[model samples]
Target: MDATQPELKRALGLLSLTLYGLGTIIGAGIYVLVGAVADRSGMSAPLAFLLAGVLAAFTGLSYAELGQRLPEAAGAAAYAREGFKSHWMGRIAGFLTLAVAMVAAASVARGGAGYLLTMIDIPLPIASGGVIVLFTVLACWGVKESVYAAGAMTVIEVGGLLAVIVIGGPALADLGVRLPDIWPADLNGWGGVMGGAFLAFFAFAGFENIVNMAEETQDVGRTLPRAVVLSIIISAVLYMLVILIAVLSVAPDLLAQSDAPLCLVVDCEKSTMAFFAPVALIATLNGVLIEIVLMARVAYGMARRGWLPKLLSDVHAGRRTPLKATLAVGAIVFALTSFVEFQVLAKATSAMLLLVFLVVNLALIRLKQVDPAPHLAFRVPNWAPVAGAFSSILLLGAEVLA
Candidate 1:
């Protein structure tokens, strides 16, 4: 191990960190999974999102508190190591965190490719594979550069969602008339709502990604926790409104049918599709970029901690990024995006994240017991982790049973 390895540069401020948080959290899930969620939950898709938001909130608090405490690169792994007093558990957590990034990126890449096909005539493998390559190069460029790119794309994606709300204005007017259509009519309908929430859980996956950026964030104890909470809250509100408009403007059945569901929100006309396909493509691309960055950082961090190979921790002195780790993570995702279909990848992602969330929540619980009153750490009430753990179990069990 090189004792004098260069550290990650701390160049991120509150706004940049917050935008990165939003970009990651809001990326893949809302753009791709919304239709899959609406298909099952029907008019009640908004409620399913709301429920998922609440579940994510409890876990988000756990993350925020832990970030304030550890603020390390492989965040969940650090939390596990500190809380459990075991190096192996930390390694397990680190690899699981890496897996989450890979699987999430794969699914996002696949979903983005579907939208890209609508505007350009290209083979599916080429579209998805090209995105992974382009973004991975951007990630290795530098932290500030990658984030600036991600932040710009985040603004455009947020604007795209607001546009959907405006375009679907007439549907909001009839939301009252549509209210009766939303509630579950029977056991089958309720089952769909439950199943839909499980899928929507994948939509809320990005909040935890912010914690991994802690090593590069200035004043991480203060900045990262705030970013985690703010991003989750803002994303939840946007997700509900957009899904509401989507279900109301078009039949859930029709939404379920299209690859680019949001384009179909305003009727999927040529002009609308022209505007939206690009925006949707940008949103998905931003997600892939962020996750690529995340996996590299985690690999570097784990290597630094001796959980992964020492080679991964070697930073590019000129670029000041994890060059080797970035390439390794990107190559894996480039291959993965071309394999599994989007929904299967999404479900697998959701299940894995739920388990990670479950373990993370438990970690916080154990950490609180070990150091009950750490000074200046962001503190959540004791019930937060408890609720987080139980809710994770509930969702995981529902997914298994259904």
Candidate 2:
């Protein structure tokens, strides 16, 4: 049987697409990157996040362009296939993209378990593995159910962060604006701020996941670019605000020391709100898990298209989920979880994602020149793709340098 003939449903709307994008982008970075960013950027953590967001915006535009032209699942892989006309290269691009995604999910899973363990004094590995398995099971049930769960979780995730902002507003105001000492005499110099930008960019990484949903999203030609651009901007702004609050509410040094910086800052001022830590952790986990599920689906889609090994293309007849690909990815995530630390996992994911983004921008530029689909539902000015391609190349260089 021709694999593509076994059609999957396309039931997602613009709102569902946006929620998935938002949820995936907003996770672990806010929970996990605060201290890492604070330590690297000093008082300039928000600035770093802002810069990273700007960099990510360029690539986001590139994705918007290709998503319209290809408008299929396995977003980057599809783009690569069309852009380069090489199935082998497309497979490599798609595989690395999905690999980083699984690595990210496992990293967050372990981190969530650590938070759970610390919160309740349970064994870390066992708790983390259990959570990962449960999330994978949920993903294998069906995309329809996953979309609803993802949308609901995104709301709670956003609310949890907002709750922190509201509860910490007074504390932040009391502290006044504590800028990271940019001057050499005060703290980390300019070099450190750039380094922090590298770290902060991770928070904005999920926008690419939007590309993978092109096959399932409603009105792909019109909605994908706008959704991609808007989601990237919205999530970046929220990250900036949250980091800014954390930076100002507590001393930078103190904020950098804890694993849970936002909660620690909140706890410092109003210990009564300590109950929200696990809530935040759950929010982050849900977001990461959703993205991983999306990644696995993308992998399965690619395999079905013959871009990957046939083994990964199989869908369970009963559930119609990409059970084979899901298990393969889960196994890789578990292996990496055992061996790697969060910093390594995050940076590696960033590096792999940067490569995919580079290709996406290139594909957009090439597609514009070769195909020139002026009637695309989402059209950027012709020059935007050029600029987006150039900027993405530069950032990819920087990602490598970092």
Candidate 3:
């Protein structure tokens, strides 16, 4: 092994890093998974989302604490390694993080293709495959360039969601439309809400992606935690508003039926909200770009730590980017998109992420007890990590049992 390790450029500031986190958190899940959540939780979808946000907050705090302690790429894996004192455990956590990103990218690619079909007539494979290739090149170009592109798309997507809220504002004002029962009285009432929360949890999955870019962020110990927390808070607010408006604007059954749920929020005849299809396309592609960037960084970080083959750590001389790792991630994403259906890919991604969160929260708790950081810029209450770990385990159990 070479004595010296390659390093990623530290060019991202708080704004850029926060934007990256927002882009990642708001991407694929809201664009595609909202309808799926509606299907599971019916009128109670908003409540389910609220529960998911609370659950995510617990884990998010844990990540923020760990980010201050060990601001590294492959964040989850690094946490596991430091906490457990096992290189093998770190490798496993790192690979799981990579798997979640790849699966999620593929899932979003498939959903993006569906939205593309609504805008223009094209074969599904072509639409999905084209995005995978395009975003792969963008991700490989440079970190700053890729993140800038993602930030712009994030604005457009957020605008799209806001448009839905604005268009549905009148509908929300009308008290005649019956709101969904907050708590279902049916036999499967609580069970269904839990199932919905499990799905909604996937929407909040991308905040952790921020920590994986710690190596590429300026003042990571301070900047990363803020970005992680702020991004989650912002996304949670937007998600709740969108879900509430969606349930009120359109019937739950109708919302669940459409591939493009938000587009259906406005009156098709009265409003020219057809532009939303393109917005959805941008949102999903942005997600693909962010995930590809994250996967590459995880590979680069692991290889630098000698957990992966050293070749993956190779950087472009001029670009100073992880070119080899980027290409590797792109290839895997392309293959996954080609074969996997969106629903299966999404469930797999969510399940894997929940497991990763479970392990990550546990790592934080163990590290606090066994190898406390000497100088953490930010600290969480001692009970925070403990609650984070137990909540994550409970959520993971719910997913498995369901």
- Taking the candidates one at a time, how many backbone clashes does each contain? 0, 1, 0
Tell me the lDDT of model 1 at 112. Answer: 86
lDDT of 2 by residue, 90-143 (tens): 887788788768877866765555346547777666666676677777887877
Tens-digit lDDT string for candidate 1 (1-402): 486877889999889988998999886799888789988888888888888999999999999999888878888888888888889888888888899899999999888876788778889888889889999999999999999899999999998888888888677888888888888888888888889999999898898989888889998878888999999988998998899888888888888888888878765465644688788889988899999999999999899898888899999999989999999999999999988999999998888888888888999999898787658558999999999999999998887888
Error of 2 at 338 (Å): 2.6
Best by the lDDT measure: 1
Which residue pairs show collisions in model 3? none
Q: Model 2: runs farther than 4 Å from truth?
A: 1-4, 171-188, 268-271, 389-402
TM-score of 1: 0.97
On TM-score, the candidate that comes out on top is 1
Stretches of candidate 3 above 4 Å error?
A: 1-6, 174-180, 268-271
lDDT of 3 by residue, 160-243 (tens): 888877877776675345554655777587777888888888889899999888878998888989998999999998998888
Q: What is the C-alpha RMSD of each candidate to the true structure, in Å?
A: 1.3, 2.7, 1.8
